[model samples]
Target: MSGQRWDMGKDTLSTLAKKTGGNTQDLGGLVKRLAAAAQPLEGKLQGAGHDAFIAFKGRVDSIANDLNAGLAAIAKGQSGMDAATRTGESDMAQAAKKAEGAANFDGAKFTKR
Candidate 1:
């Protein structure tokens, strides 16, 4: 048996982090387009015997508004996640640099003077 271990959680996290921004934008755009397309249908349903149709159109408008709000919330959450990820990456790099510097300093101090 080959000694290869697969870490699925790490791979999933990396893929999600890479795609979060693009996916969020695409979803937001689709929601906005859906909302826009629904707007004209509201006007087209204006007739005397179409009360139910009018009511349904109103409900559709409400749903579109809610979807847009949800999209905004998703975007805000993605922004926060991106900032946190960048900060985490920077902290890890800084820690690695400090550890490397300390390792070199200790070697030099032990061998010289």
Candidate 2:
């Protein structure tokens, strides 16, 4: 009985070792194939990232240019408004001086009451 039990134990251990060895070989082959498959994808991902960065930089530049143009327009409009205000003030001052002179004149001499 002891001999039979020992033989069975030895056979089971041998079978387990054979299966473990085969599985290890298969795992190594799978790892190699996975690495090969991922190589091209890694390069493609890097290229995609670079392209996206360039596109993003272009967009940022365009936005900055547009903002600068808008600011320039706003500055031009502000200068124009300042000029118009100064002209209006000058005209008002002249009108007020004329009214003052007219008030000092005797209206009774120019009209028969």
lDDT of each: 0.60, 0.56
Please, what are the lDDT tens digits per residue for candidate 2 over residues 1-113?
A: 77865663324444544455445445545545554565565445657776664454446545545555554555556556556666777899999999998794665577658
1-113: candidate 1 lDDT, tens digit per residue: 23333443324344554566346556656655665677666667657636765565456645655665665666567556667777787899999999887785655565545
Q: Give Cα distance to truth, residue 61, candidate 2, Å.
A: 2.2
Candidate number with greatest lDDT: 1
Where model 2 places Cα greater than 4 Å from the true spot, the runs are 1-54, 105-113
Highest TM-score, which number? 1
Worst 10 residues of 2 by lDDT: 8-17
Q: How large is the C-alpha RMSD of every model relative to the true structure? A: 8.4, 38.0
Alpha-carbon runs more than 4 Å astray in model 1? 1-52, 104-113
Candidate 1 C-alpha error for residue 30, in Å = 7.9
